[model samples]
Target: MKLVLAIAPDRFRDEELFVPQKAFADAGVETVIASTKTGTCEGMLGGAAEATTTFVEVAPEAYDGIVIAGGIGSQDFLWGNNDLIRLVQTFAKDGKVVAAICLSPVVLARAGVLKGKSATVFNSPASVSEIRRGGATLTDRDVVVDGKVVTANGPFASKAFAASVLSVLSPISP
Candidate 1:
């Protein structure tokens, strides 16, 4: 079975994490949630989930892909995290699927992987500026897939974003 590592801020978006996790589960893929620190993570919408490990503990070579869950906290916690950025870079270097939704795509932009890639993020002047600075072409689509990197606008596109990740990681679409 394929395995994926999901990295989220302590305050991740509830749907961004849960929706993709469920889709991966139903497709027979295993997912492990990680954060800057392990243990409980609260969602922006008040939902809670446990992070099985910390980002520093993850080995990029062991997983088929990486998914970044987004929320308001993502701006404060994830955007400039060096460890998470390294993980994203490792995944991209290894040609693994790299995905992010909402504001979290800025992490990919900050990691310098979104350069020249067409991707979408929750439209905000800040986010659009960041991605464009990193050389990405901003799009208005709900979900944009460029190579193995997938990006979505927000919670509304969570299901489709997860499906897109699955299709990239698996032979069959979920």
Candidate 2:
């Protein structure tokens, strides 16, 4: 099965995380939630879900793609996490799709990917800087797909986020 991995920390945006997750599921692509730790991770909305898996920690070549979730937890949990960075880069180098949405597009820049790719972030200063530094053309849309990397604006745009991810998973519409 094509693995679509969603990366998150203890606290990630609920809508941004799940919307794309369910999209992967809808496309029959198996998804696994990877966290820095093994415990149940809390969502930005105030609830939690169990992380069924942890980072490969060995080989990033295992997953077909990686989706990074954005939120306060990204700063708290993933700020200094090098494994996450390595994973994003590994997937990107393999020509695998990498996606990040909301305030998390910084992860893409730090991963050293998304360079010269058109993208979007949540209209935050950090996001703007990261996108520019990465040589990406930023758009003012809810969802922006630059090559294999897809980004969404915020929680309000989950529907478009899911649709975009779905389109990435299966290149054709039925």
Best by TM-score: 1
lDDT of 1 by residue, 17-103 (tens): 999999999999888888888888889888888888887899887788889989888888888889999989998998889999999
Model 2 Cα lDDT, one tens digit per residue, 16-129: 777767776777777777888666888978767667766644356566677777887776666457887788888888777788878777778778787888888888776788
Model 1 lDDT-worst window of ten: 1-10
Worst 10 residues of 2 by lDDT: 165-174
Q: What's the TM-score of every candidate structure? A: 0.94, 0.87
What residue pairs are clashing in model 1? none
Best by lDDT: 1
Global lDDT of model 1: 0.87
